[model samples]
Target: MNWIEIAGHTGALLSSITFIPQVYKVWKTKSVGDLSLYMMLIVFTSTLVWLAYGVALNLWPVILANGFICFLSILLLYFKFAFSRKVIVVAKVKESE
Candidate 1:
């Protein structure tokens, strides 16, 4: 692949892995109260658009990257809501400090 194409894939890989630490932290701590639902929603929506564009253009890298990123977003979103009210309140309280 050309340098430009390689760069694109590199960017895609980096972006796709961006959420790994966040996901791991949240999952381990079970604390997502500080995370904004709206932001996650926006990311999810944007990824969907990116995925669609990639599909339309027949870009595998884009498709794979956005697809994985979208899944992470959705997983985080679910964690935010799936967390119990008590846990959320405690998490928020801790975040305030």
Candidate 2:
């Protein structure tokens, strides 16, 4: 492969791994209370679009990065809901006290 291909693959690898920290945080804390659900929704939606665009254009780097991002965003959305529910429960308990 040429340098360009190498660079593209490298970028894809780096971007894919970048989601690890967020995933770890969500997994460890089971909390995403400070995360913006709306923002993540928009980002997830946009990543889907980007993946489609990459597929249409046959751009491997874009496709790879956005695909992983789509998965990560979904995970984030799940955690956001879970965390929000916990927060609501806590609030109710405190209110009752």
Candidate 3:
């Protein structure tokens, strides 16, 4: 592949993994306190738009990268809600005790 394509792929790989560590950390700790829902929603929306743009332009790098990023972002967002609710439930139980 040409250097340009190589760079694109490299960037795609980097972009795709950005959320991985955060996902793992949150999953392991069951903590979403530091994650911002607004930022996540904005990023998730932007990823969707970028994915659509990439598909329309037939750009493989953008398509593949944004698709994976979309998945990661959604997973993180899910964890945010799930873990936050879990914390609230546990707090309620403790309060009642």
lDDT of each: 0.89, 0.86, 0.91
TM accuracy, model 2: 0.77
Best by lDDT: 3
User: In candidate 1, how many Å is residue 83 off?
Assistant: 1.4
lDDT of 1 by residue, 10-97 (tens): 8878999998899899899988878888998998999999999999999998898989999999999888887756666888999999
**Candidate 3 regions off by >4 Å?**
1-4
Q: How does candidate 1 fare on TM-score?
A: 0.79
**Model 2, position 88: C-alpha lDDT score:** 90
Worst 10 residues of 3 by lDDT: 8-17
Which digits, one per residue and each the tens of the lDDT, describe model 2 over residues 16-72? Answer: 877679879988988787778898899799999999999999998788789988999
Question: Candidate 2: deviation at residue 63, Å?
Answer: 3.2
**Deviation in angstroms for 33 in model 3?**
0.3
Most TM-score-accurate candidate: 3
Clash pairs of candidate 2? none
Scored by lDDT, model 3 comes in at: 0.91
Clashes of each: 0, 0, 0
TM per candidate: 0.79, 0.77, 0.88
